[model samples]
Target: MTIATTGEADALPEILTERRGAVQWVIFNRPKARNAITPWMEDRLIEICREVDADPAVKALVLTGAAGDKPAFMAGADLSCLQSVKTPEDYTILEDRAETAAMALEAVRVPTIAALAGACVGEGALLAACCDVRIATPSVRFGFPIARTVGNCLSIKNLARLAAILGTARTKEMIFSARLLTADDLAGAGALRGVVPDDDLTERTQELAEELAGLAPLTLWTTREALRRWRDHGLPADGDADLLRLCYLSADYQEGIAAFLEKRRPVWVGQ
Candidate 1:
């Protein structure tokens, strides 16, 4: 459907963008590929998150996959993109970008929600874990096939974040065996708020988002900040803080901010 305000469809084929009251709704646009995160899609995702962060009108955010009349959030990072990173350094750069995007989602001032419907696998699972709330559909499944498929290590930061959010035992089972968690199992394990039928998932998610939007803005923002800081505060003596500082100060950050305020799509010059 066309978005009357923007003169565009509410959702794009790659990523649907819309505003529902005080909530910024970003739906993954590629259901054909199970909503995999392509490199370009990753860039667009970060830009959208940055825009939401700067918008005072947005009180909450929702991330889900674009599945018509169904629930399927995202599959994971695009396997196609991984083919280019042959060397260790190349892989590290790719991970850095993904990590930056994940951190950006956490840094948003408003509460974020992720609706997991079908295949929330690999990097997609990690992204969902970072959100403040997660809702799943009956057919939803979660797993990271990285150990078996990618042969890449999950960063210590991601490991800690997942373990803290999902707890030690569940986290170990998730990462070690790379087993997929069914929606019912996740709900029982406290990973998701509840499991809805696929058809009702969007309605339920919107209901929760709207509920959050009605709250005192500062109250929610500060609460989110506190939770994030509490978890990120003890990050070990890695140069992550310094690196992240540099990223915020970089020319890309400035371009991103300017483009967002101008309400035009950013032309990211990956500096």
Candidate 2:
């Protein structure tokens, strides 16, 4: 595996960077908090998705940890953004931003891998699950604890994707109980292609990414689009439009935005 790392202080802090051959990487840099997804990172994440989609040189993209050493491949949403969310309205705006990033992950024109390690929780799990492939280490833990942590909802498209990938029973257990599954458990449940020792995770991920990158770009993109279309069939028309509306029209959305910019807890008025 050819590894190339770049540290750009001018680059967005919430997300980091690296590139290998035709494989482009977008690393979630908030390791201290287990790679928590911040609002700034949200925009950066979408931008990276667009960047890869538009760049002809990037045939396969990987979303992974910075050097694959974090305690979490991705932990989840940044809870710091939730305090001012007093009403469902305010909550939806935040959710919309997150869903946009997630949608971009799904819509990437090239093959994508969620090279997961450590804890893949909540939003992180959703992000990984959005990828075309998920590779994990033995130490990885996966779950969506939103039912317990916040009243936030997952977009129907993402919910359907999860159900398709993990199956109804397994998806139900994870969401309903907010249970965290170890790598072995997730593998048995068919959530990941394979699990390796921690040391081999990064190399194996690179191997897979490079392999995909070698394939014909148009073929890969067409395949991804076909799968996406199939998933869309399972979702209702205007589903995403409604999700966007739910967030755009919410009072909580207003508070959440203000609070995020202010770097303080949102004082929700439940407008």
Runs in model 2 lying further than 4 Å from the true structure: 1-12, 67-70, 237-271
Residue-level lDDT of model 1, residues 86-150, one tens digit each, is 44466567878898889888888788999788888877888898898998888888877543343
Q: What is the lDDT of residue 155 in candidate 1?
A: 62
Q: Estimate each model's TM-score.
A: 0.80, 0.80
Candidate 1 lDDT score relative to the true structure: 0.74
lDDT of each: 0.74, 0.75
Compose the digit string of candidate 2's lDDT tens values, residues 39-138.
Answer: 9988998999899878888878888765423456777777667655655566567777888898898888888898878888878888888898888887
| Predictions: Cα RMSD each | 10.7, 5.5
lDDT at position 36, candidate 2: 79
Provide the lDDT at 11 for model 1.
37
Quote the positional error of residue 14 for candidate 1 in Å: 1.3
Residue-level lDDT for 269 in candidate 2: 53
